[model samples]
Target: MASQNRPLSPHLQVYKPQLTSVMSIMHRATGIALAVGTLLLVFWLIAAATGERTFGDIQAFNASLIGKLLLFGWSFALFYHLCNGIRHLFWDAGKGFGLEAAYRNGRLVVVASIALTVLSWVWGYASMGAL
Candidate 1:
């Protein structure tokens, strides 16, 4: 029989949030966001094939404030996912195992993802003559 006074395992409340833990959680969240974003992409493609009215409606929505916000968020998620996936690849190859190295890489992932997203959006707008 187990002791009633003692818990079987440490609960989440007992632990402080660390960079690795936060990054891991974000990695999973971005993955889910990417799936949802992919659905949006599919919807756009379907609208394109459906008719001009349908496609125009989709385009109009994409040009709206809320839609742009969602698209920006999705782009961030995409870049974040890509950066973190690369970090995982490095880990799988037995690199960045130290605590300091892990933290450094985690910070790099965040910075790189943000930079890439912003650069892509800027380039996109400039190409579209919207800049």
Candidate 2:
């Protein structure tokens, strides 16, 4: 009876985030973000195909503060997915399997994702002259 309801095993108090754990959770998170972000892409594409009126509506919405915030998140998610995907490619090649290497590469993915997102936004705004 005493052992019937014993607390299973290690608890949350013992859980420290490791690189693999972080990556695992982030991979799922980015997957969800990517899926949600696709709606924006689809909207843009449909607007483009349907002509200016529809596109203008989309543009108006996109220009709104909330829309801009969503777009920023979408952009970041895109870059994050891309960076992590590259990390996965390296893993497929049997590299960066060690804990320290995984942590290093995980950080690299985060830094690269942010950098690429900012750089992309800057260049895009510059090219379009519409910021």
lDDT to native, each model: 0.94, 0.88
Instruction: Please write out the lDDT profile of model 2 over residues 40-115, one tens digit for every residue.
Output: 8899999999999999999999989999899888888888888898889999999997888998999889899999
lDDT score, candidate 1, position 105: 97
The top-ranked prediction according to TM-score is 1
In model 2, where is the ten-residue run with the lowest total lDDT? Answer: 10-19
Question: Candidate 1 regions off by >4 Å?
Answer: 1-10
Tens-digit lDDT string for candidate 1 (1-131): 56887876748678899889889999999999999899889989999999999999999999999999999999999999999999999999999979999999999999999999999999999999998
For candidate 1, give the lDDT of residue 67: 93
- Residue 72 Cα positional deviation in candidate 2, in Å, after optimal superposition: 0.6
Superposed on all Cα atoms, the candidates' RMSDs to the truth, in angstroms, are: 2.9, 3.7
Candidate 2 lands at a TM-score of 0.82
Residue 69 CA displacement from its true place in model 1, Å: 0.8
Global local distance difference test of model 2: 0.88
